[model samples]
Target: SQQGEEDPQALSIQEGENATMNCSYKTSINNLQWYRQNSGRGLVHLILIRSNEREKHSGRLRVTLDTSKKSSSLLITASRAADTASYFCATRGPPGYSTLTFGKGTMLLVSP
Candidate 1:
């Protein structure tokens, strides 16, 4: 079994600042997705980028993928206190397999 590994295990920032996290995986993937989890809460899906796509964005989020390097990055612009959470990257296995492996996570803290 393979999994994604997130970087910068922890982070701290002030409100209105920006936050960025990176994820790396060992195997080929169908798609890579980002998520946000508040303390003791369920994960919230943020964005998804296919292996063939180089970049994607959703609102304040910017995601980039480099298949050749087997890595991806997530950037949150104008981050707010509410944006403080653990960000993660999930990798979906190829076509038929029903496996979705999640990276450990990058913790982002935004103070008011």
Candidate 2:
């Protein structure tokens, strides 16, 4: 079952602006990952934060996880028009398993 759901189904912003998206899950997870997808392309892994980690960063992306709240948020700084895409959050089950449940995704539009 898919455990994660992202809020703000769609968002629009101008270039150089920042974009933020939040995800909430229903069950415990070993780790949470964020991915990005262009119009019709495959998803690109952005970043992953372990269960014990509170935050992680990569490039212009920043992610924060709160196990107690079963939620996470992804923030993109100084966004660009090229950054327009659909972002999804995925949750992985415990160690012995390799299953991943993905959210419907949040569509972001970064206009120039």
How big is the positional error of residue 112 in model 1, measured in Å on the Cα after superposition?
A: 1.3
So what's the TM-score on candidate 2?
0.97
User: Which candidate ranks first by lDDT, i.e. highest?
Assistant: 2
TM-score quality measure for candidate 1: 0.96
Local distance difference test, candidate 1: 0.93
User: lDDT per model, in order?
Assistant: 0.93, 0.96
Error of 2 at 18 (Å): 0.8
Compose the digit string of candidate 2's lDDT tens values, residues 27-82: 88999999999998999999999999999989999999999999999999999999
Q: State TM-scores per candidate.
A: 0.96, 0.97
Clashing pairs in model 2, backbone N/Cα/C closer than 3 A: none
* Clash pairs for candidate 1: none
Lowest summed lDDT across 10 adjacent residues in model 1 is found at 92-101
